[model samples]
Target: MRISAVPDAADVDLEKIDLFDPLLYSDGDPHPIWTAMRQRAPLHRQVLPDGRQFWSVTRHGDACRVLSAHREFSSERGSLLHQLGKGDAASGKMLVSADPPRHSELRGPLNRMFSAKAVASAEPRIRRAVLATLPPPGHSGPWDVATSAALLPMAVAASFMAFPEEDWVDLVQWTSMAAAPEDPSFRVSSPAATLAIAHHQLFDYFAKHMRHRRANPGEDVVSYLTTMRAGSEQLTDEEVVYNCYSLLLGANATTPHTVAGTILAMAEHAPHFLRHGDADGTRVPLLIEEGLRWTSPASSFLRHAVQDVTLSGGTVREGDAVVVWVGSANRDEEVFSEPFRFDLTRDAGRHIAFGFGPHYCLGSALARIALRIYFSEFLRRFAGAELAGDPVHLRSNFIAGLVHLPMSLVPRAGT
Candidate 1:
């Protein structure tokens, strides 16, 4: 990989650039900013307008170190930039916000449930769910990529978790509110209102299901976790609800963005992104990896340093918040050759899009299965696809993605 020359520390003013600003993500591109930071200030400290501070890690090596060394850089404080200053209410209880050995205890059963074998067993149901989102054979017109794609992940998650299928569409709305409330399309009155309504609805819905599932338990995620145990400890009602919220939030938030981004890349990026997908069905996995890499839907994760640690960039003091930009790390020119070019022929060797180490995405297998089936069906049904209208990006520093993608798919002859 060739190292591109960027402005030195003397030339680029870092303070003026607010990485936390959702507008910067919605209306502008942050990749150039990340590239500049990667070269000049890989471990630069950023102060919010109110004087609160956190360190931003942009380089790939430093991100890996920070994410893998989970103990030294703990998540128990908070795991997202939005949760800065104020600690997470779900800390220690939620899998994404918990630190080990408790993180392991909470995650072990989920790991088994989300393993490859489990996804394979559920693949047929997942495929059925995915197929419902696309046009039927011999039919192709204008497709609402955003509206249709968002349904696929929720349907898969709800089916697996045994949540009512009737509520899948609303669950998508709740996730949008939770993940990108600032966005005009998703917001309700105010961000606080957005959060309050989403949380209340989600928790209330899950609580009802939890109580019912306890009596009429079956082979589903809620029931499985309700009975899951590590050693003598079992998951509490709160833990079950919070974790289910985490699961649904993740599915609704990340997977659809990935699907849209991959489609956008394929239809709009001209030559570079479409090469691998047009090959054979066997290449769908590789395409999914590239899509995950290119979009990096979950932009950054925040970890509080429990102990003083040294990164490739510099030293992180104890009690300091460490924001690892996984999106930036995925696009680091040092790790990837021509990082901007969306090429699927290249191997998915170094992307930390799903994150790294102990906190690597629990839904990764399920996500891949969803995408694989989605793309497989898409390729078979559509002769080609193209962007049809202006794409709308979600306004968020946390969940980075487009909220709406208008597209048209060309139906294959005889399909």
Candidate 2:
């Protein structure tokens, strides 16, 4: 359903108040605004100059309830505020956009591919990919972590999709543009145009492989999709294509930024934790949880209400869009004491950075695995690091991250 304008909010200042504004993320820290809203207006309203309106959920409990209550809040409508007016075209076809029984049927075959055991078994290759792509252990000049470290996730994802190894670098570039189309680094004619072009290129690329896999089937996810059945029904060729797009997007969106953001946090507050290999593995878990909580890269996701529902004392009418700020929820004062402080020891177990319910990130395990290996190797090489320049943030409301992280690595003593 197309979202209609809220005539009641005609006087609101969209430029200053719109939660979907990219400038809120790119220009400076937006935490204060979120903090204010979380406390004073946990269930807030955001109206765009164009008249599109959405409810902004900022508190942890409210965020969780809204994200998980799929019956009341529909994912098939749209999953991002960028589609506030026009709902998702790939709805009901892609797993991320499907709800209930359909979502379950579609997800069952794919779950094992990223199960914990699967990721554990893939660790050897993941470690090798990390080792191969990482800069020299002792190099101590300014390093662009975003550009250099993106290969590990891309490599891991490409292997699963059966994308060629030689195309890994190109895949990385395409995925990044597709992920953060508004960033000047990726913008072609405009943000919308950039996103469209990137998707066009990606869809055409996946179509070639999908068609090839029809006759020459392989063990990869795309190959499986080309032939796999859901009970008596086969996935339409478009469904296979949409799933491929979703998987490629999942691989590119989270971890690299999480790495860059964690590195930023390390440079800023937790440098003392570096250089130790975490030989026991226990310390790394705390660091990983806290880093994911602090960074919160999958910043916001959209859900349109399917029914009139009351949440956190506010009534959300049917058809109203709700944007849950996972980034803000991670920092909710009630959930994390002094949520702003980067405390590696704090138990960040309640973090809904992965969202909640059926729509939770399928690649959460892979993202964690990527971070675990990357940090272990990073610390063994560098004693500590600090920012050489400000981190360039991605101009996206859905994904929060560093576009470029300029940092000087401190090599292990003597090397």
Candidate 3:
């Protein structure tokens, strides 16, 4: 059942094999080509316009190998397809791009912040935030669910990390620009410009807070990060600043999309709505997992092979960039049963929605907490909720998620 591999040269000549555009990858339709790759050329070679040759790893098992075998495929080269432009210091420090030892060292101390206990403990506050934003009992019309859904994760994350509440809106803006660097229309020209503005704004904001946190370290993750001493290898100011910056963007962008995507999934499969009665409590968690697997916010991750390693009988030479198609892997039939069917009870734990191996999402627990809280409250409030209009997904392929979810909420009778 393998589809033939379209050679890197043939399709690429006419702007066919574009790995750079986030829209192409983020459209959530890589399976057709990916299936072809897995069955025929599991290790297909791709050539960028600039003549950069990369190995496209499409299957579930091979993707896992690339992500896990850090020794073989290094994250140091880059984590996405974006060019590593000169003076891009922040990209290197972010956990997504760093290799082991350094990555492990940076991520180790802050694990507790994203742990289940810590996230669970923030439920009361998260619930309040979600409740505040829910549509009133009888409301039913198009409204932006993405903006409303964002409050839960951002509020919880800011509170946990000691980020200022008044700055939440700006923080969200900064993080969005940083995460979706490929989106030209998000702001002025160049993803670099957007990132530079965001970096300075966030760094200045954090520097002010860092002074206070250093003087009187609290129970928050930022406080812990500021004071941590990892055997004479504590985090530097830049690391601390960028780590918070990265965490804020990562935590904010993904979870809300999960909530929005889950709602869309529910609306699309209205038949499933019958199973949960008017109570969404029963159906929300399952919806979250499927939404994550379906939408796959992180989409594709970029890795560089350290040495010449033969993958799927193709030769990936040293210094070659490898694009790991995660969304494709999520839909691979070999790993997931009936990959297209949105089965609520399916065990999708193995999906690479969050990525694989050492660089797996650090804030997974927190992301889940935010998603669960929003859905739990959403279900409780609006069981009969459905999309009032077609949703708009972000233009960029990187960090794919709904930019606008126009939906109406209605109260259920039983509840």
- Per-model lDDT: 0.83, 0.81, 0.70
Top of the candidates by TM-score: 1
lDDT of 3: 0.70
Q: How many backbone clashes are present in model 3?
A: 2
**In terms of lDDT, which candidate is stronger, 2 or 3?**
2
TM-score (C-alpha, index-matched) for candidate 2? 0.94
Q: What's model 2's overall lDDT?
A: 0.81
For model 3, residues 154-226, the per-residue Cα lDDT tens digits are 7878878877678888888877776776554355477768767876887888777777888899988788878
lDDT agreement of model 1 with the native: 0.83
Error of model 2, residue 178, in angstroms: 2.1
Name the weakest run of 10 consecutive residues (lDDT summed) in model 1.
1-10
* Tens digits of lDDT, candidate 2, 315-358: 99999999999988988889899787888889999999788888
Worst 10 residues of 2 by lDDT: 1-10
| Model 1 spans with C-alpha error above 4 angstroms | 1-12, 270-279
Model 3: colliding residue pairs: 22-397, 23-397
Clashes of each: 0, 0, 2
